[model samples]
Target: MIKEKTFTLKDNYVCTSQHKLYALFSFLSARDAYTFLCNWFEKFPEHKESTFYIAGESYAGKYVPELAEVVYDNNNKKNGSSLHINLKGILLGNPETSDAEDWRGWVDYAWSHAVISDETHRIITRTCNFSSDNTWSNDECNEAVAEVLKQYHEIDIYSIYTSVCIGDSARSSYFDSALFKTNSRISSKRMPPRLMGGYDPCLDDYARVFYNRADVQKSLHASDGVNLKNWSICNMEIFNNWTGSKPSVLPIYEKLIAGGLRIWVYSGDTDGRVPVLATRYSLSALELPIKTAWRPWYHEKQVSGWLQEYEGLTFATFRGAGHAVPCFKPSSSLAFFSAFLSGVPPPPSR
Candidate 1:
């Protein structure tokens, strides 16, 4: 599935900060992905028949579904010469599906986990109308939300149960506004401190250090006439200027579900950023009929998590896992992914 092709939407390096701000939107990214896929099939024609699956976590909840929808639409609208992509399903972990539900869940999860005071939670739940576009504009709601940020400021908001990285590289002058943003504006300074290496909060810091090395850049061919000075896990410029983001991707979920695409949504119970509660609340809005009653799923003779299968979607949780489920619980995540690919349930405790 790996091949070479060159197509530029904005500039030579699509992620380089020097490009015009035209490629940051979700739909635009999806369109680019579709175009890339078509070009790949045309180049290799032999692998066009392979089953494909789209997977991502966090904000990719939007990207994955949007790309799948674009692929589905193009496949249906194909002419005799057009290629058909055999898209099978999608898998998402601790996804941000709906803005309203995600914010609500953030507040609720913070309060439930004892990260915030009851008074603060009461203030937020009372004053903050998450569904409204002007929620943060309200002074009372704004203050309450700010208090929530203040409470999370000291700890790793992405994984409340884990220790934070105290290294200089992990420190930032401004608050991380990757997930905490208002309707009208996104903070352009710091990106979210997303942890990918299980309990290690400094993984991105290490990655930044390694990727910035002159030798590393030369080895990766990243320094070849690109003028790339710095490499970050996320482009704050693109993130700040992102457009065409739908408030909710539930409509696309409904459309794909009806189209008979296999969908699985998993959550790491320990993730405070996009917590399990947020996923539950967002998915509950779909109201799909339950196909399998909720039950515990086991791995290696131990209870790994719980799962509930809906008519067109499957919801599961990874116990003791943080933002990166596989990093925290590789065996359990592997079992869960195996089940997803095979169209079966995770190992049940008999």
Candidate 2:
């Protein structure tokens, strides 16, 4: 029997031209999904007491906190009408919590990892002001960023060191086309290659094949109206419609941490997109007193990651892992999950 339960939400953050006018920051996809979860819990009273923990990675760094705030606010409300969700804690992996810090951190990560030249890094740091939503610090900053980006054109920004799947030679046509489209966003022709270490660069190809299959869709009861053949990893329309992002989640972290909730922010050290450096810089802004000194944590008698406990939040970094920690380091991620849920610290030192 399964001891754990999972509830996944395919939040349609898409807003067409007509629906765009009504779109508000608070009523976006995450909020909508939270409302559904709350209502679901209310309808199914038996599971009301079960410990609920919100978890996500990457962009979810933002989504999880926003949703947690919604849950926390409702739970604390005096009104007896609302159900008190047993929200135990929150878990975030390589989250994009702050725009300014993340961008700033990216330059640092790139430079430190030898992805770009020291001179370029110096120019970027000197000119770029990541504090605002605008892309570049200045004209010079934009040029410096462009110069650095050229170096990463052929590599997977998500996993800087890992190789990505090339065109139809290694994967199917659909996968090749998807990769092409991604590169087209940056106006680059070169594609990424797949590297070793239990990584499957062709997983997107497999997913495209599996989801587009008639029988699989039928079994899952996917809608007939939506064309499976055209399905992509990320819907561009939905991504374009995402208009509610804040500059930083530090304020939200301040509120939630002060309220005494278990918060864990873990990063896969290898991920260049939302690198561990960025997470560190963002968390430093919180200025939470250190509850435990920084140290390495172990799993299966091996060093899994480094973890440090703040007053109410914990920050961790999985060694040699990518943006999606579970995909790259499943065992370590499971260890982290188990510890987060149990309110126990990861084993110190291997």
lDDT winner: 1
Q: Which stretches of candidate 1 lie over 4 Å from their true place?
A: 1-26, 78-81, 176-198, 224-228
Q: Per-residue CA lDDT of candidate 1, range 117-178, in tens?
A: 99989988888777765665677767677677677766777788888877534345234434
Please report, as a residue range, the 10-residue window in candidate 2 with the lowest summed lDDT. 1-10
| Off by more than 4 A, model 2 | 1-25, 133-137, 168-198, 217-229, 237-241
Kindly give the stretch of ten consecutive residues in candidate 1 with the minimal lDDT sum.
Answer: 1-10
Residue 9 alpha-carbon offset, candidate 1, angstroms: 20
Q: Assess the local accuracy of residue 169 in candidate 2 as a C-alpha lDDT between 0 and 100.
A: 32
TM-scores, all candidates, are 0.84, 0.80
lDDT of candidate 1 at residue 145, scale 0 to 100: 70
Q: How far out, in Å, is residue 319 in model 1?
A: 0.3
